[model samples]
Target: MKPITMLALACLALSGCKNEEPAASVPSVELRGRLEVDQEKTSARQAQGIEGEYFRRVLTVDGSDMTLDAFINHYCPADTRDETCQKALRIKKIDDVSGATRFLPQGL
Candidate 1:
């Protein structure tokens, strides 16, 4: 039996199997909250393996509890309302929320 012939037959036998059920999806809920920023992203940590800066926030959406993480190129520890601070975060908001940042409560 030739290798090419055997391979063709194997593929033919496997093609009949089909998934009967649709993929399950998670329900999404509207959430709003404050950010618990971890101020540990010094120059040394980033080089080691830490990914940018990370923040942890607990949000209960529709009765379920969960934690979320956020990263940034720069975070303004100063007043988030400061024009200078918001200007810094502009890059992140435009680029899928992965750049300059300042953690602020929901209302500003």
Candidate 2:
């Protein structure tokens, strides 16, 4: 057998014996924020003939304004429209939220 071939086989064997242990899973943080209706945007949507409620949730995190929608998209899987629904987040909790609780907006 060639030296290069032997070296390659030895390296492969060593890699196989390396740690197979699973990495520790980090807990997700769930944030709680005020679910307020954005009437101005809603009105704009109506003017444009779009039907539906327009919402912008504001949450203060570490003394900064954070968009709840942004966090949800980052933490949850999106649908075809590139949007994450409440049901999806409820089904699967991911990423760091404040209270580790699922966010659900009423009548949305």
Candidate 3:
């Protein structure tokens, strides 16, 4: 084989051997904002003495609601394989708050 042909074939083989993986999908901006707003609303309800102890226990710790970013970092940090965290992140509606809270640790 010609030297140039050999070189081209080697490059093609190397390219095929690349171990690149697909990039992780990031949460959409709308979803992020919605989660933050939900947290804020929960906090407000708690302040008004309307929210229940279960919500207070799950969503708030140290007498404060966990910010959306903090919750995501704590529950679903990068490369986390926890089933509860995955389920929590999948929650899409405000009505699902109860379900999501179930994924969190209680008494904290």
Candidate 4:
């Protein structure tokens, strides 16, 4: 066989034997942040028909499936026309079922 081909074969063999260990599985926990829109900017943002600076708080959680981004998108839609409903929403909890627990003004 050609030198280059032999060299390639040798490298491939070495790589195969390097590491066959299974990847370590780390237990993941759910992290939920309660949304808090800035009161000062609320009026201005509402007038402009846009969202203002908001924050989130970690509510009840028991899993590791839901993420901050996913929770927001699933529960809160940017273009949601229901201003009244939006205003009423306060907190969201990450649950075990959908790995997300959305806690509005009413309840989770």
Query: Candidate 4 lDDT, tens digit per residue, 45-107?
Result: 568876544343343334434445444455455555543224324233333222233453343
Model 3: ten consecutive residues of lowest lDDT: 28-37
Model 3 lDDT tens row, 1-108: 699999999999999998976544433222222222346656767898876442322344345566444555654666777554554455423325552343433421
Per-model clash counts, in order, read: 0, 6, 0, 9
Give model 3's TM-score versus the native structure.
0.30
- Residue lDDT tens for model 2, 40-67: 8779878999887665555564566655
The regions of model 4 sitting more than 4 angstroms off are 1-27, 38-44, 49-67, 70-101, 104-108
**Model 2: residues with Cα > 4 Å off, grouped in runs:** 1-30, 36-40, 48-53, 75-88, 91-108
Displacement of residue 29 (Cα, Å) in model 2 is 5.7
Q: lDDT of all predictions, in order shown?
A: 0.44, 0.52, 0.49, 0.45
Best-matching candidate per TM-score: 2
Query: lDDT per residue, candidate 1, 1-47, as tens digits?
Result: 69999999989887767656553232342223334444554344577
TM-scores for all predictions: 0.26, 0.34, 0.30, 0.23
TM-score of 2: 0.34
List clashing residue pairs in candidate 4: 30-63, 33-57, 34-56, 34-57, 92-103, 93-101, 94-101, 95-100, 95-101
Error of 1 at 60 (Å): 2.2
Residue 81 of model 1 has an lDDT of 59
